[model samples]
Target: MAWKFETSGLDGQCELFGVNIFKYRWRDCRETAAVTDPHYGVEKMFHVYEVEIDGQLRRFAAGEFSNCVWGFYLEQG
Candidate 1:
C-alpha cells in the first residue's frame, strides 16, 4: 500500500511544523478490555518549527488540529 498524500514525505520535511495526534492503545489496554480503559494519544502539546529561508525566520505550527491542515515547503539549495 502507498501512503496517501496527506502523510507523504512526512519524514523528509526540512522542519516539523504541526500537531499530529493519534490514539494508540497501551498499558494493557485494548478494545476487549472489560473494565475502564483509556486509549492514549500523545496528549496535546504545543510545537513549533523553524527553518531559515533566505536568512529569514520561517515559523510554522499546527496550532490546533481542529482544521486538520497539513503544510509543507520545498526549495532548491
Candidate 2:
C-alpha cells in the first residue's frame, strides 16, 4: 500500500512554509532514526524518516511533542 500523507505526522494541510510538500509526491518510508530536540533543551525524542520526495529521497523528523501534539520537519543537509 502507498503511504498516505495524513499518516506522515502532518495534518491534511500539505502547504508548509508556502511550499506544497505533497506536490513533491512523497513515497514510502525508507528508514527511521531517533533524534533529540536541541532547541527546547527538553530532550524530547523524535523519529526521523527517510522518504522519497519528487522521486528523490529526503529525510524528515516526526513524533509527539506533547499530549497528542505531533509535528514533522524536513531534514536539512
Candidate 3:
C-alpha cells in the first residue's frame, strides 16, 4: 500500500477550507495455491482459496474474514 498528500484552498490557508485523504491505493497481488472440493461435505469447502480478479490473482491462502467483502457490485467493468 502507498499513500500521498496534498494541500489546497481558496485563501491558500491549507486549512481554512481543505480536503483530507485525497486518495488511497487499490492494490493487487498474486501467488501459487491449492484447490478444494466444494462438495466434500454438506457445506461448501471454501476454507483457504486464493481469490482472483479479471481472470488474474490478487491474494494467496486468503483466509481472513474480518476484511472480507461484505457485498460487491460491478459499478464499472
lDDT of each: 0.28, 0.48, 0.23
Q: With candidate 2 superimposed using the best TM-score fit, by how many Å does residue 28's alpha carbon deviate from the native?
A: 9.0
lDDT of 2 by residue, 1-77 (tens): 11222223244444543455545544446555444443464544455555554456665655665555455555444
Model 1 over residues 1-77: C-alpha lDDT tens digits? Answer: 11111221232232332432222111211112111111233333333344444445543322232344333222212
TM-score of 2: 0.44
Winner of 2 and 3 under lDDT: 2
**Which rank order by TM-score, best down to worst?**
2, 1, 3
Rate residue 77 of model 1 by lDDT: 28
Winning model by lDDT? 2
Candidate 3 lDDT score at position 12 = 18
- The residue ranges of model 3 lying beyond 4 angstroms of the native Cα positions read 1-46, 64-77
Q: Least accurate stretch of 10 residues (summed lDDT) in model 3? A: 68-77
TM-score of 3: 0.16
Q: In what order do the candidates fall by lDDT, top score first?
A: 2, 1, 3
Question: lDDT tens string, model 3, 1-77?
Answer: 21111122232122211221112122323422233322232211122222334455332222221243111111111
Candidate 2's C-alpha lDDT? Answer: 0.48
Q: After superposition, how far is residue 52 of candidate 2 from its true place, in Å?
A: 0.9
Q: Which pairs clash in model 1?
A: none
| Ten contiguous residues with the weakest lDDT in model 2 | 1-10
User: 65, model 1: CA deviation in Å?
Assistant: 9.8
Task: Please state every model's RMSD to the true fold in angstroms.
Answer: 16.8, 7.8, 17.5
